[model samples]
Target: MRFEPRRHTSDDERILPLINVVFLLLIFFMLAGTLSAMDPFEITPPRSASSGEDNPRDIVVLVGADGRLALDGTPVAEADFEAALAAQLTESEGARVRLKADGHADATHVVALMERLRAAGVTRVLLLTIRDEA
Candidate 1:
């Protein structure tokens, strides 16, 4: 009786393990990476020597250099800003909020924003800034 030798595995079979590993890596990255919503507009945060870090959980208020405003990543018209903010304040558990203002934003505007936040009953407002790399 003559037995035939086994044929070589196809290229597809050879690549199966690589494909599985690549898929596994993709899944791993997807699970391991943290995804967060980006700001509606670009903002260059002011520089500071403080080593404070930002907490992603905090609700953020954004102010652009050109006087644009966004709340929790959604653009809000200047006229509607207070109403929107007050609405959020009532539903929010904490009075804490984060202010992310552009580096070039006017100081008075920022202060006015803080006053507005205070008037709206926000007790703890954290100003976000980038660490100076000097």
Candidate 2:
């Protein structure tokens, strides 16, 4: 008696389950992604006594200890800082600005930056700091 060879089955039956798993993983990652505007420069901000809540979409301005200034991670001259801020504010009405200054930064430097923001029509400004750990 002659024995017939068995036909190999295609993997088409397993494709649907694999596709479903991949889709679910994609959705999970999308939802789990943390959305926050982070400063490009690493700064050790001064501690604050106030328990101010942080907004995710606020524009950030960083002032380094050496008086270097950056807005949204882009370095700008002291004279051009106001113009850059104005351009940003023009895009969003009533947009809030957050200032992140190094702990060792001079107080006067921070104050001057704040004044510039005010002059540029940013009415609301928030100072960013790390909350002290108990």
Candidate 3:
């Protein structure tokens, strides 16, 4: 008596399940990733000795070395900075503003900006600084 041999399945059936699993995993990670602002300009932030703690800021103002001012990554005229800040402060009653200035930024420029923020009724302004590597 002769015995019959079993036939092997096609490659498409084996690969389809693996392809579907990989796509499912990719979709899961894409949905899980954090979505935040991608600031266009680059700035070497100053370092600070203090380890201060505060809640997340509602507005982030960036000051470039060439005296350029940006609010939430959008460029704005120096004259209009205060007005824009005032509008944001009014919308969020007690929200704080954070300032991120380049390392080479002038102290006077920062001070002047702070004064403007204060005039706009922003009492709490936190200066952002990077922690030095040990």
Per-model C-alpha RMSD? 3.2, 4.5, 3.8
Off by over 4 Å in 3: 1-14, 31-36
lDDT: worst 10-residue window of model 3: 49-58
Show the colliding residue pairs in model 2.
none
lDDT (Cα) of model 3: 0.84
Clashes (candidate 2):
0
Model 2, which residues run further than 4 Å from truth? 1-38
The runs of at least 3 residues in candidate 1 whose Cα sits more than 4 Å from the true structure, single-residue gaps closed, are 1-34
Candidate with the greatest lDDT versus the true structure? 1
Name the TM-score of candidate 3.
0.73
TM-score of each model, paired residue for residue: 0.72, 0.70, 0.73
Candidate 1 CA-lDDT value: 0.90
Pairwise TM-score winner, candidates 1 and 3: 3
Candidate 2: global Cα-lDDT?
0.84
In candidate 1, what residue range of length 10 has the lowest lDDT sum? 50-59
For model 1, residues 1-134, the per-residue Cα lDDT tens digits are 99999899999999999999999999999977857667899999999988666665667999999989999999999999999998888777765699999999999999999999888888999899999989
- Please identify which of the two predictions, 1 or 2, would achieve the higher lDDT against the true structure: 1
lDDT scores in order: 0.90, 0.84, 0.84
